[model samples]
Structures are given as C-alpha cells and as structure tokens.
Target: MRIRDTGDLWWKNAVIYCLDVETFMDWDDDGIGDFGGLVQRIDHLADLGVTCLWLMPFYPTADLDDGYDIKDFLGVDPRLGDVSDFVELIRTARDRGIRVIADLVVNHTSDQHPWFKAARRSKDSPYRDFYVWRADEPPPTHDEVMFPDEEQGIWTYDEQAGEWYRHRFYRHQPDLNTANPQVRDAIAKSIGYWMQLGLSGFRVDAVPYFVSGTADDHADGLDDPHDLLRELRGFLGRRRGDAILMGEVNVPYEEQRRYFGVETRTGDEDDVQGPVGQELTLQLDFNAMQYLFLSLARQDVAPLVDTLRARPAIPRDTQWATFLRSHDELTLDRLTDEERQEIFAAFGPEPHMQIFDRGLRRRLPPMLDGDPRRLRNAYSLLFALPGTPVLFYGEEIGMGENLDVPGRLSVRTPMQWTAERNAGFSRAQPRRLVAPPPDGGYAPEHVNVADQRRDPDSMYTFMQMLIRRYRECPELGWGEVEILEQPEPSVLAMRSTWQDASMVTLHNIGPEATTVTLELDDIPADTRLVDLLQNGEQVIGKDGKVEVTLDSYGYRWLRISRPESRRLL
Candidate 1:
C-alpha cells in the first residue's frame, strides 16, 4: 500500500525547523513566546524555505520540563495563547506551503496532570492503572536512570498511591502505561484530535521508553510492544494518508530498525516476503550526529564516513532525520568514553560547557569558535547528508548558547531577532524574558536575524542558499550514498545518484586549503561538473578524473552534467 496518496513522500526531501513557543517570540510582551508571536514570524520561516515546522510541545504544561511535562494534551497553554491562536498559526504556515508537526509527549505526563493527580489520590482509583506501579518495596534493578545527574533511580516511591512508580526521565514526570488498552486508546485519540486540528504529524518523544513496557505490566491482545506502533501507524494512515510519525529512538542501528517494523513473511523461512513500514515514518540519526561532532572535533572525516556507511537499510517509505544541534544537549552518549572526551576537549573544554557527563550544552557556532567557514562547511555537510535535514530555531542566524543557564536550557534561549531590548523577542524587561539571550561576542547585537538578513554573506543568507540548493538537488535526499575515495583525511567526498540525476558533494573539514582528485567511474569523459554553490563548471578529464580545489573549511556541491542533457534544476 502507498504510504502517501500524493505519490510524493514530502518528508524524504523536506527541511524541518523546530522551535519552542515559549522562546521563539513574544507577541503579548509577557516575556514568554506565544502563538500570536509565532504567527508574525511564519513569513520568516517561509523565507528560510523550511517545508516542515516541528513545534516543541505547546500543550498546557506544569512548566517544569520545558513543556515536555504536559498537563493537558488536548489544550494549548493559556500563556502561549488559546486554541484560536494555534489554529491561526497552522493556517498561516499551511498557506506558505509548510506542514506543522507537534511534539508528542505521551511517553509521560506531568505529575500535576489530572489523570496522574487522580491516580495518586486513592489505591483503587480508576486512574490508578493509568501509570506504572509496583506495590511492594521495589527491589533495586540494573535499569539505568536516564538522568544520573539528578535522579538516582528510575522508580520513585509515591506516598499517596502507597506504591513505587516508574519514571524514565524525571520524578515530576511519570511514565504512562501503554500496556493498558484504555491508555493506548487515549493516546490514539489524542493523535486523531490533533490531526483533525490540522497537524501533519508528530515528533514522538522518548519512543523507546514509551514502548518498553515492564515485565509485570504485560497483558494479552498486544503480545509484542511493536504492535502498538503498527496500530498507531495504521490509524494515522487511515486518518491522513500522508501524515507521519517521527520517533526519537536513540538506539543502536539494529535496535533502531525494530522500531521501523519487521519484514513480514507469510510462507516458510526460506520463502521470504517483502518488508513493510508499519511503524515510524522517520527517526533521528543520533549515531551519525555523534560521529559528525567527532569528525569536527578531530578535523578528520573517517568517523563520519564509517558511521554513514554502517547505517542499516530500511523500508523505502521510512527515512532518517539529520541534525547537527537539537533543542537538547549535543548528546555524545553513543560514542565511546575516549571519543566523548576527544569531543569535550575540542568543543566543550570547560566544565560548565558539558552536561550530564554525556553531552555538551552548546550549539555548533560556539563549539566551532564562531568561525564562519567552519560553520558554513558544517551546514553544507548537514544538507548534503542522505536524509531530511532538521535545523534548530536559532541555527540559521548562527546563534550561540548561553552557558550561564543550567543544563540543556543553555541552548534553549530566546530567538535573537534584533539588537534591541530582549533581542527583539519581546518588549518585556530583560529579567522577564523567557531565557536570556547569549552575551558577549555571540550576543544579539553581534548576531541576529535583522542584521544577518541585510548582510549578503551572513549565515542566514548562506543557510537560505543551502536550503535552495538542497531543494533543487533531490538526489541528495533520495539516492544511494557512495563514499568516494579521496586522499585528504580532512575532506569528506561522496556522491548521491537518484535515477537519471546524480550529484557529488565534497567537504574540507580542516583549516588548510587543499586540492583532491576524484575518479568518477562510469561517467563519459569530458563531462562537465556543474557547480551548484558557485557559478562555474569543471570538465572531467579523459581518464574519468577531476581535480577540485577548496578553501579552508570549504564545500562543493557539483551535479554531473553529461553532454546534450539539458536538466539544470
């Protein structure tokens, strides 16, 4: 069955931009960003050429976990404007040919949520089964707590319920029991309700934790936990044929494949059947992201090349979401201790710049020391990767993180729009702003949207160019990646070929300019290499080799142009 009735899976080539309502823009001047302010900035996103806007939970929350501790799944936080404002934002974004997807935080809920509050009230309460609970003194298990810096254990004793409840992340946010049919139905209803309100899809939070049910909580009917994903996928397909479910499952490649669904076989083991995408439409490539930072840290592209080549092949409809920096910390937990320290030494040398002993609480600009060449090269590689690219809110303008803020919030500062008060995010006082903008070199005065928009060579304009070129080259998004062999260890060379179209991209991650000759087999001699970033083309020699020169930390996106072929998109 076709996943999308449109015949075009938009996500395969979509550019996703993620932002938080409380930090994006403040229209009410209450020091907090709202939908009203977001609406005013929809044009900015359109101008940036993003196809998908991933909204970080604007739901009514207790405001403890950066909106992830959802108090009400169906209602928008009054602070961020009412339901009407949300609908208007969706409408405006849609009018600009952009699809909106919300953060689905059903893995857990705020302890203050009505259901959780009711569950804690009595032992036999109807909502008691809404959460995972253990009656006796919970024995110590080897289940590692998510936040070792704060929480010491995953199970927290609840005095009200007279039992120990499990929480994968934080104590204030309790995990919901998916094993319960009613709870599963409630989750499905929430998805349907949001889709009815015009959301294209969801960025499902903590998918592994959401599906990993406890042994004691097992039930009949849904024997395998993955069946729940199949159920949700089927429901989404029926409700909206093109809607997607992007999951945040940061597991090993093999384990990650399970979340994408298994190969369906009707006959014997030898008689294998075709594969089916019964689960998530897309997943974040945490492994590749880690290797990317490692490559940047060491100024060597071997790690990244290895990681990309190691990725497991999945079903056609499913894809990977590539990102450099996200809303959370730049997690390096997937890497080895030695590799993690190598990144920390290069990027997060100071202790304050590190977080949770596993990741760096910084953005790419600051990590790269605000070097424009390096930043441009990094973003170039991001778009050239073999997946849909995702950009954090402030990435386009080269925003830096405020290490003063504690933990991951360091990177979750307000958007810098201008050099004026509150960085043009709001009219409120500096103290009242949602989160203070970065100070010093990377402050709003030095780096902002207004200033960058005016500068022709600004990072914002560079990002716009990259987005434009990326949209033009569909091969980069929907093609087989072939890592081209080159001499320079600091240069990453690769080719992406989709059908009749082919493109070759090269990145010099080092600080010195160099030239590399690549052997392009199968292509006819004297073929022209059409440069996508610049206004020139190089002809391939008769030996099927081409010499390309690059500046320090430079990149090139060249489309193979054969004689008499007139496609120049």
Candidate 2:
C-alpha cells in the first residue's frame, strides 16, 4: 500500500456522469456495450463538460442484478473487454481530464463465484467462512431485508453444504462473511488490485448491510458498517493517494451523514475530523433526491425545504453525491404514505413503473411527460443544490425508459446515439442485443442525439448550458447553502456563499404562475442580482426585499456580486 497526501480533491469540482458499460455503446458488434465503444465515445462526455465518470460495473459476472453479482473481482467481464482494454480506456479518458470510478459490490457475490461454489461443496472447505452460513434455523428478519421485492428471506438452503446461507439480495447472491479476517483481507486485496488498475476509486454498493448479521458473522457487530468503511477508507488512502469511496447509503440526511465518517460505528459515538480514521469521502444525498420528487409530485416545496433544513454537518473534506435518478428505482420511501401516494399518482400513475413499493422504475423525461420546462427546473435544482451532482446516463438527452424490461431494468436501455437501427449502438441483430432501447414515442427515430444536436432548444443543449453555468459558478457546489425566507409556499429559495461570491436560486414547484417576495436583509444594499444566463436581471429594492415572478415550473439562479456603484445595468 502506498500513502501520499496529494490534496488534489478533484471530485469536489467535478461534474460526474454515471452509466453502465453494457448500456452505453457497442464497438465490437457483439450486441453489448464494450470498453472499445466507450473509448470511442469519450469525446462526447468530454464535450459535455463531465469531469468524472462513475461506471456501474464492468467486472466479470453472471449478468444478474446489473453486474452487482460478481464472479471475479480483479478481471473485467469478457463481454465488456479484457484487462488491456480497460487500462487503455482509463488512459484515454484521463487524457481528456475524465477520471473513472467503478462500482464496489462487496456485500454479496453470485452463487456462481468460485468461493461460493467451493464453500457449498463442503462445510470443511477453507472457503466456507467466506460466505454467511446458518447452522440453526434461519431467523425471521424480513423487515430489515434490503430487497423485499425479489427476496423471500435472508437464508437459502444449499443442498450441497447441507446448511442454510444468508443473502440480503437475490437468492443467488449470498452475503459475504465480512467478519472473517481472511475475507476482510481478500476484500482489501480486491481494492488494491483495482487501484493498481489505475482507477480513481469506487462507488460502494449496499453500504448499510455490509456489516450486518450475527455478531460472530460480522467483523463489526450487526447492522454497523462503520469499522469496515473506515478500514476501506484507510486502505484506499494507503494504496492509492486521493482515491475516494462514494457510498450508496440511501437513508435520510441525518442518518446518511454518518457514511461520511462524522459518526462512529458504536452507539451515538463520533469524532469530528479525527486523525486516526475516516469513512466514505462521498455519499449520495438521498434525502434531497427523495424530497425533490415529492415536492414536484405535490407541487409544493415544503418537503424539500424541510429536508434541506434538517441537513447534518459533514467533514470539510466530505461531499454528498447529488442525483436525480440512479441504477435502481427512484425511491420515495423516506416520505410518508400519503406523500408517496401523491407522487406515485402524479409521476408513476401506471403501477408498472413502481417497484420496491416505494420507488419509480421510469426515467425523468417520461415521468414528466417530456415537459421541457419542468425537466429543466428539476435538472437546474439538482446542479444548484449542495454537494457534487451525479448525472445518469442518457439523462442529458432526456432518455425514456422501457417498461417491457422486467423489474428495475426499465431504465437500463441502450444509448440512442443516432436514428439508425439499434440506435446506432450495435450492428448485431435485435435478438442478439443485450437489452432493447425505448420504443414508441421515445424510440431512437423520435428522440436521439443526432436530432437534438441540431436543435438549439433541445434538452441536450440545455444540459450543456446548465453544465457551463455550473462550472462557471463554483459557489453552488463548494460554498455554504442557506435556505432563503420566502412567503410563497410554492417557491423554494436558497443562497450559496463562498469567498467573495454569493448566489441565490429560486424554484417554483407548483403548476400555476405566482410571484414571491424574499427578505434579503442580509444581502448588501449595493449588491445586484445578475442572471448568470444573461437572460434577466433585477435590483434590490430600498425596502430590503426582492420580488420574483415565476411560471408554473420556473427556476432562477442569480449571482449577487457588487457591480460598479450597484447601479442597474
């Protein structure tokens, strides 16, 4: 392991784009996305101003759970590419200033994994402890199980071993016995292998259940993954300097803050920026995301305001990964039943789009019915919110989902590059393709990159404009966020301050046009609201208040800089 305090912190100022390799592009005509295709398309991401790429998973697997079920940790999936292709992809991507982070799915492995296969052969096998096994009758802990939609219970009877095994997700994926020293060592070794592969870091999957199980079954006690996370953080730091561990802990803001190393593994224990250990460098802000959709669903902004107000403190080095949608369904579990129902009725009216009883399996464009204004507002809010923003694949061009695909696979369609067959993704026949692209209104012929690139008012261009503005205004990501006091319940207001710069963003969540008055007493009397987009401008009134008029789903981002004499331009 190598340790160095590079202090690069490139992720803090990065625009991250997340995608699955199998769904991005196909280079070999093998009917699947591959490293060669991704390499060929690196310029597209670079042109979009993406500073980092968060890949879902490209490891060898049984093609279950979107590559979360790992068959080999150190090698690349033969379908995607070999080791040389991945290394070349990284090198080429780096040349364009885009760092890559692959998914880390250590919580469980496919039953087809060598260790699991070996362990099932006999209880006396040395690999037996690599996976959790229940000698006695398995406990009834369905309430805490992660995947209630797919799994029945935590234990599965393996006839080969004559014992029951624990699995938090699908039955084929057995939970790894992280409590074992050898198992822990193997996990660490996997990390080292990837680091040596020249990866920047990993996006940790299923963090909450990483340390859960019987006390003897876990190196750390049940339901507490802090120690393992800390160990992983330390290992990352030592093996490859400045590599980050972005965790997927989707709890509310208060509980989610613990993933950033501010809280301890034990009960209510914590140390503020302790020197000894650290946890995840980045955690997805599920609180903001859940409430973002809720606010939109009810056409009310209170849910979002409440979530932002309840935000917890994180270490200065830590950041929250902001996103609109991810690999799985967009879950509204954090909200109340009534609130979730309101959202489901509005966005996911058809029951086919909902999953896990609290999430929507569809993408944003179709959910909003392709209303450009609302989509722009939501995307604007995501970029303007605190922490680093994570853009999902094809979200930039307003890609739609395919409900025909089962489970959460609805959103995992092939990238529509052109209007040609297979959306210019592959030359293989439709039957040989991995997963079909959207059909009907969202089909490649209707909505594709080739069409949007020529249209100035397209979502593709609008996303580019958003990214340009986001990069131009660093305060939105690196500065402090303060919720503004506005009388309009439909309008959400907030201010970001950093160094000598301050920015204010106002978003209207309701369907009706309205005017809002924000109390700007704290702002200097001479400061003016400069529209960063060069579209509109307003001056502070002598009464220490600012009035904003917005359309049904309008949003405004204003920069408050002391101009020449504070006079109106």
Candidate 3:
C-alpha cells in the first residue's frame, strides 16, 4: 500500500524527545522546572536532532496526580509557570525547528477542580453530573480502581451528596462523564484553546477509560466510548484542521484496534470504524513498545519479531511512537504471569534484578549492574527499530533509575546538567530536594554531555553518530522493513528498503564472536557492502559466499548496492 501524503508535516522523519519540563530545567531556582526554564533548553534539544518535543502535562493541577489531575483546562500550573510561559515555550521550541506536542488529559480532572467541588457540594448542583455519579445503587463493580494499593474501589462514597463517584485512577482524579454532552463540549473548548496558541498536536491520556463499563460489560474497550472520541475529534478538527491526535490506549492488541477507529472485531452493527469521528492520525503502539522492552530484558528476539509481524498495518502517513521507557511507574502489568516468570528466570540470577524490580529503589545502569557495553547494545536496537523513536529524557546520557525516592520519582530525576551539587538540577540544598538527585555514579563528572561530546567512542558520541546517519539516509526513516531469516538465535538481522536503495542491519546479542556468511546468490553478485559504522569498511568479493566476524554485542548497518548501481541514492 502507498503512503498517503496528508501534508501532516511535523512528524515526517522526526525524532521526538520526551521531556518532563518540570524535571528538565530550573532556571528560576524555585526548586521546580518552569516554562521559562524549558524555553532556555530548546537549543539543546535542537542540537540533538530532535524534530518534535512531546512535553508532559503543564496544566493547573493538584500535584496529586502529577499534572494529569487538571483543575483548570485553560491555565498552566503555577508551579510550572503561567499560560504565558507555556505559550513562550511553544514559540521557542518552534523557533528551533522543533514542533511541540502537549499532553491533553481529558479522561479525568482533580477532585479540587471547581467543577468537582461544585458537584460535591450538593446533589442538585448543575455540575453534579459533569463527572460520573452513581446515585442510589452501589458503586459499579466493573469499575475497578487502577491503583488498588491506594484505593479499594473505583467509586468513593460522598457523604455530603449521599452518593458515590467513579474514578478509574486515583480517587482525587475523578473520571469525567464523557457520555454527558456538556463534559464533551467543555473538553473540546479546552483543547481548542491550546490549538489556537500554535500547539502542533496532543498526546491524549488514558483514552480507553473515557467511557465506563456498561451494566453487563466490564471491559475498558471502545464499545461505547467511540461516540465520545468521535465527538471530540469532530470538535477538534473544526477548530484546528490537520492537528494530530495520538491516544494513549494501553490495552491488549485486540482491544487497541478500537482506538484506531475500528470499533469491534466483527463487522456487526456494534463495530465502528475509521477515526472515531474525524480521521485521528495516531495511537501510541504500546503493544510494540512493551514487546521491545521484553525482548531487551529477556535477551530474546523471536517474541519481539513475532509481535511486530502481528501488528495490523498502520496507515502509511501514521506510525507508532516507539520508546524504551517513560515517566510512568514501571509496572510488569504488560507481561503475562508466565512471561514474568521467564524474565525472572533469566535476569533473577543477576543481583541487579533485585534492584530493578524494587519499585524505584535504585539508579538506572547500576541497577543493571552498570555495564556500559550492555547499555550500548540496548540503544543500538532501540535506534534501529522501525518507527518514530522517542528518547526518554537523560537516557542519551545513560541515566539510571533511582528507586530510593518516592512514587514513580526514579525516572523523574532532575537532568544531570553538571557534576556540581545536586547534579546541577537546582540550587536548592540537599535537604530541600523535591526528589533525591541522582547519585555520583551517573553524575556529570562521568556521564555529562559536555564530557561525552568530545570523546569519539563515548555512548553519547555513538548515539550522535547513529542519529546523524539516520538523518543522512532518508530511506532509513520511511523504508519498508524485512526481517532476515537467520539460523542463529543470537543474530538478529533485518533490511530496510526504499525503491532501489537498501540497508542491511545486523545486530549481535551474543557474548562470543560469530561469523555471518551471506550467500552471493541470495543477493546481487556485483553488490558491494559498505559498513556504515566504520566509515566505508568495504567487502569486495562475491563468490556465492561472504563471511564477516561480529564482536560481542556489536551491530552493523551495511549499505548494499551493485557496483553498476553505485549512484543509487
């Protein structure tokens, strides 16, 4: 199938950098990252070859649900900066050739929000129905609480109103009643406000929970919620034509299809198809992302390849948002019990496994036993994958997870700017740290950008070279992927092809050296293989066989072309 030229310009050949602005920079020294602080870092992101900046929520929030618990849709959190700060941040990022995609959490609002407060004050309050309210009956059994450790049920009893309210996430973050037309209209207006300020797109949060479970059905699929999304899409399309909308539908592969506008598996009346309403462009491919992590952690490639092959073909103009990790708590919910057991069996022998699973108690690489070689291999696979790659903040510098801090705070450590006090995150004293700063293990003394920028063999430099190669090769960005059939389990190979140009990508995951022999008959006899990483390491002969040795965890991207077709570009 041919790719549609939607003229949706921002995402094409883009490398999106996921930046938690609050944790990115602290220019004002208020012990928090503000928009003005983020504005100052646009040049850094641009220099890194990032085409889009996916900013986490900057909305007015109670800080309980981070910024997801929006109290005011039109305002930015005072702790983060004002609406003016956000506008300036967007403008500054755009000026640096980086498009901005903000988080739009429409599924829920903070309990302290004016609408929620007014709703709870009295049963007859006009805002009472703005959020889901179970009047006389018991709270819906199917409505399960996402945070079972903190809350027992999805509904909390409101003594003042003599009712129970639904909350799919934390109790303080109540799920909006999307079935209500008023709520839908309000959310649309909020989205429009940002669109008017030159926002490129939105990374829609918790899209599957927009609709509650029906009396007979308890699943969080898009059975009845399609209408809500359809309505939202219609309103947003009218306000801002061609604006991208990517939903965070973290569900099984079967159920995820619904978020892409295919309502049901069967072609029945219940099945809705196409864009939920207007043609929504993309949805976060959690399926692929999860499989990728599993493959890396387990040191297995088959499951990942199987999962990738199983995914339904996406529209050519649209693509998956690939990532290694994100700001959310690292829960093993994506893995099945058997798969978890397998991962444990493989990694459990290592001491690092204890720290890795201890729920934010350890730093990143140290938790993985601080092996830079392993880190390099992980990133090689990440960058070579087929999709829009999103680098979690500080990952390029080899930042580790810090679990000693509280509540999903490990991945949210302040950017290690310099090895100065508190890793140069803030001027605040050690005792006043919002979240404990990263220890000296990965501090600026060793892993800072400044130090690595000068070293040719450093991981930072390696990543820069790889990204530069990706930028140089347009085929690498939009080429078709073909996995090579190889006998060795440790050898994973694939080819990216666009028209006459092709690139053979080979990755060695084994600890021992292995020779890969390519049959000359399988490819063009007159073809020449140029090693991309080695700056023109070439292979000359093609006597129906060509052998090359790969180092432990080494990767190669060979640009292949027939001698006669040397001008292939």
In terms of lDDT, the best-performing candidate is 1
- Rank by TM-score, highest first: 1, 2, 3
Model 3, range 203-266, lDDT digits (tens) per residue?
8888877855353432443236776676666676787676677777778776766555644446
lDDT of each: 0.89, 0.84, 0.70
Per-residue CA lDDT of model 1 for 177-244, tens digit only, reads 87778888999999999999999999988888873455656756553668788888899999998999
TM-score of each: 0.96, 0.94, 0.88
Predicted candidate 1, C-alpha RMSD: 2.3
Name the lDDT value of residue 124 in candidate 3: 85
Lowest-sum lDDT 10-residue window in model 3? 354-363
Which residue pairs clash in candidate 1?
A: none
